[model samples]
Target: MQRGLSRSSSLPATSELGDALRACRGAFLGVGLMSCMINLLYLTGSFFMLEVYDRVLPSRSVPTLIGLIILAGGLYIAQGVLDLLRGRILVRIGTSLDEAMSARVFQTVVRLPLQSGGRGEGVLPLRDLDNIRSFLSGAGPSALFDLPWLPLYLAICFAFHAMLGLTALVGAVLLVLLTVLTEFMTRSPARQASGLAAQRSELAIASRRNAEVVVAMGMAGRLTRRWAGANASYLAGNQRTSDVAGGLGAVAKVMRMMLQSAVLGVGAYLVIHQEATAGIIIAGSILSARALAPVDLAIANWKGFVAARQSWHRLNGLLRAMPAPTSPMQLQNPSQKLAVENLSVAPPGEPRVTVSEISFVLQAGQGLGIIGPSGSGKSSLLRALVGVWRPVRGHVRLDAAALDQWSSDDLGRHIGYLPQDVELFAGSIAQNICRFDPEAKSDGVIAAARQAGVHELIVTMRDGYDTEIGEHGGVLSAGQAQRIALARALYGDPFLIVLDEPNSNLDTEGDEALTRAVRVARARGAIVIVVAHRPIGIEGVDMLLVLKDGRMQAFGPKETVLAQVLQRPAAAPIKIVSDGGVSKP
Candidate 1:
């Protein structure tokens, strides 16, 4: 079921990712300070080379040489500690990002299918979030942080010699151009790869879900061929992106190395001409390499950078499309009635309305049966009634308050639903029946099971209530899963129970048990709406609605609607069955 979409309003425009990062901004500031210190300390080797060559070797002073070595070693250690600390801070920032937004990301994943009307579309948001966090924590971010200090190293190179500075500056420009080229060349292919990957993943998931059909019908080879074609497209796109990034990264590395050698050769000429000391050669080479190191690292990690950037944009768009909903007030548990006014609902993520202009009112203790042909929207109506699909044009009111006026968490507690396809989480039978309530009482679980008339079947198992149900209740038969789902719907004795094709898989015994459950629900003032094709499935509903082509054809008390649709005589009597007797309505 779609959770929290019915919340009355959306929040104001804001970047959720930015907001999450801001919560961790203090640590970021601290990391920046450390980067500043670390970059300054990077100058140690250059200066030590300058000092040792220009002073110590010429003077032949052992004490001075030893002191310089000790000082330089200490500075190197400090830089290493600070660098390590900065990396740790980046990791923590990633952790902070996850801690702040993982829940929101998961919530969006759940709600995404409701908007897109597809199961696999939701898988990307969580993956996007992971991509962002991984980039932040990895060496990619450190390369970014180190980039700003490039000019500092360039200035120092100029102080050593003008030619050395010119060499380093030209290398920086070339590397920057190469980085830009990599980005432009790979962007389109990267985007195409991501789309193809999602498509391939969705197909694989769908094929696996219907694996039984594939194996039973001998169509495994056909699916495999289709899947292989999609995989080939994805691989081609991915390969193109990697080729651009990888080739440019190699160029950047070679250019940086060439720039370092050119600076050294320039320093050698300057010293030979007696315009610079011998130490200038080593110092200039080291400084020029340091200046271009960040650019080199960035080019090497360009693919990761692009992936992170795209993920950021996708996350931004998703958050904008489904802005965080404002928390609605807790409304009273709906008791007296359930009303749908001028309602028209399309399938989730669909544009054409499938159930149109539906208006109805069901009083407390009344049970409604929705009957129609396969294409007549009986199941769609039930979905809307339980707040799964948002109506394009109407209100689903509970008591006097609209459904949107209640928080989904609170509203969920008051409404129970069983969809046409039964799904059971992997857990013990007791957990499935109690809807996984942490504080569920065993008595309530037993009561719900007994009400569904599945208690006898459940207790026959070796572990009984404690028996584990595998994913999708893989160990249970079709009839057993349906019965357990019914028990779940009746778990809390919710004010309204919406069931779609409640007995589509049931045997005769199961059908009789379902009728008793509906009777028990109405006896306790809980409204029941069952969408069913079989007449036996409507056994206890007080009201009946017939539909054709998404529009209502007839609606009223069960017998009256039946008689009118069947063209019965006006004088004919209709028998309405209660627990053990019949009455005239």
Candidate 2:
């Protein structure tokens, strides 16, 4: 019953990173203006030297010398103030960027696993955002901003003498060439190193998380070797990048020093020829060095620059691939009726469908049990129903409105879902049960825990509902985690409840509690769907949907479908000998 999707003519969208950058355009402009003022004030030292040597010393006027010193001190103070303001502005810009993009990046990270079928990683986006922020507030970007003033410094040198200006210009061009060469040599290896580093970090984190398994299985040595291999590759790539950049940096430093000396020598010649004064000679040397300083600083910080650039590209790509956020519609809460039409789902990054042409309808005050053998798509169907996974074709609607049409926050309020593998965040029992709602009522949280039959268990704990659950609820046992997760799903008495193997970790009492919880949910007129494998698991369900090999094998009232399946002829038996040989009968 599934249908193919239709193609649309819309072009791809831009990234939130771009939007954030545009929003900060005003701040950047202010920073640029600050840079202009700072660079202008940078002339204070050279001019002070010129005034002292050219005017005060010749006139032997102590008052003039003192006044010049005071003026120079005031200019220096102004330069310091401007520098401080520019630094503060950059910090603000970085903070603003984070404020704008952090929430969106976090949302994308959470959604990526579903969109890409569990193939996406979350840490990289967060890491990229941090990298961008650090670079903005670091010295690298300031170096770039100051780079534009290099030509102005050269012009000041030219005003001193043509030879001095030529020396400064040649030196600037040489340093610029070195910077370009540094980029060309290190670009590929730097990129490779960054990718390898991320892989190493991921592996290390995984190993730490599964340390018990590694220790119990005596896999420490093997895993260590694997990590070492990846680490070595990363180190090699990093060393290659560093070697090239370092070599160029050394050459640039030497060339800058030689340029300063050459400027001094040329200025001295001009002074001897009576074309320039002693003050002009010193001033020319200072301006020439200033002209080349930004280039040298840029070369020295090339690694940071490359890393930030790569991070920017990655974040931009991730944001671009993400769907734009839609304004939340003022839609009313959906009624408990649920419908699935020709639904099909495929695993992420794979073309083969896992579940196909699934169609069903369930109204309020009814419960359905999905029974299937291993690999029968039962869990996949439940996931699709609850909006955890997107269907390849067709629609899942609640009260005739498509699930995608509802805002997630609004839909979440009306839907409750518990997966087979349960997880609880690090918080108190009450917080987890109440879905961490800041405004959750105490009575409501207690009611949910009571409905799940874990209220007695909570009372026995040292702090009752206020007891903290450690990371992933590691402080609690398997049964405790499962029951707590059930309480979380039953919170607020949601209209649509989907549970996948809710009693998988429960004992006899727990199982009874689960049955009662389902009955209670049905009594409240909720649409309940349970995925199960055992007969007892489906005891209270009114309808049955049996799946086999991704197709619907049977669907109807539980007794009718059960009777039909039971009456069908069973498969022929095979005769087996004591030697383990089997004969078809």
Candidate 3:
């Protein structure tokens, strides 16, 4: 299981996303330029009305009127073309942003379990990325881009008349204030709604995943009520935000419409007083409407803007907290020298340690059996050994190098692990046996199956190695899934194998297969550690490690530990001596 040269060195820490945005700066610039031209051309309609009223009609020249109409049509066509170009540029920018961030977001999701020790939802990051992409391509950002040109339109209004300009400016300021009010009123409630929505989603997912249990236990009504409570909370928060934003939006719309009419009224008064011409009166009304268009649009889409902003902050914070990928040292594959020094591990998000100050060492070709009652930190220790759970203190080393020093992908190739609850992904039997390695060879897959003693049983299926396993291997029996998971752990002849309850679902034949697999792995110069409750599961193990209440009880050759355990009084607490010895109470 040799790895290729390190590719992580080429990946920048948080700069790739920045670089992607920078790459699109030119495109956004082009969009801005097009928007400027589009806004400038928007005056064509006002100008057309002005010339027809003031010049064409008075002059009574059909040629002048026809020429103005043709020129206005050409300007409208140019504006349409620029509008289309800018829209296309925004769409391309959105696509480019997705292309740049999607892969990295997916990578982060895949590594989340390892980084957080199996806590957190993996799908949320992708959802956040999608939110960002949608916002970038949508009408919301287009309105923001046009917003800066509002002043230019108001200037055009001022050139028409000072009273018209003042009316438009006051209207714009009021709408801007309304926009701010919408944000202030809805921000907290919107954030609350988003969080509640996520919680409701997770709850629904959990309920669906355990639908069978809920049905068998007759918990449908209770679970439904529970879900309903969460949904109601989500709806309440959503409604509050919508009410505030919608109310402000309606007021802003009314204000803009009234302001447009008010501009026309003011311009008419100015015209009557001979302060402005009839053409300027009509032009002022049109320009005033144009100035407030972007503000209206921004208010209409305020909720979407808030959602995208929150998603951006969340995604940025998550990515920033993630450790930067490092170029792993080109270390040779370990030859089964495993060492755990003063290791302590706690559950994720919990302060209490599950396994504490445990230490051990094993050389190549040795097999150790760990036996303990439930909740004795058996599985926790195994997780630490396989690099699934990082140590809270101290370290686990392979061949004298800390496990954290290796790239996860490279290290996974040399280590095999089977958790207490075996789970097989949705795929063919061959794929699961090969650990889903796309480049796995057929021979290697079959060899691993044979090593796990499930080759003959697998052949009995109609599709043999190609048989499709349903989700979580639901199509298979408990014993069948356990054996297949063992085969997966034994795949690629990994130097270090950690198995938790490998024979919990096995029968007589399956138990014999388990023993044979362990013996073969040991003979091939691998370090094997099995966590079991049954004595038969430890048949060929050369050493034994006993744990009780998160502390080591005994660890030595299998025969010596077994003898010591056998001699202890059955009803009394086993006394642990300071010199790694055990005595009866």
CA deviation > 4 Å runs, candidate 3: 1-20, 113-122, 571-585
For model 3, how does the per-residue alpha-carbon lDDT over 153-271 read when each residue is reduced to its tens digit? 99988888789899999999999989888888988998999899988988898898889999999999999999999999999999998998898899999999999999989988998
C-alpha lDDT of residue 335 in model 1:
90
> How accurate locally, in lDDT, is each candidate?
0.86, 0.84, 0.86
Candidate 2, residues 174-210: lDDT per residue as tens digits? 9999999998898899999988998898889889888
Measured against the true structure, the TM-scores of the candidates, in listed sequence, are: 0.93, 0.93, 0.92
Residue 545 in model 3: lDDT: 87
The runs of at least 3 residues in candidate 2 whose Cα sits more than 4 Å from the true structure, single-residue gaps closed, are 1-14, 572-585
Query: What is the number of backbone collisions in each predicted candidate, taken in the order shown?
Result: 0, 0, 0
Candidate 1 local lDDT, residue 263: 87
Candidate 1, number of clashes:
0
Q: What is the lDDT of candidate 2?
A: 0.84
Model 2, position 162: C-alpha lDDT score: 82
Where is model 1 more than 4 Å wrong at Cα? 1-13, 567-585
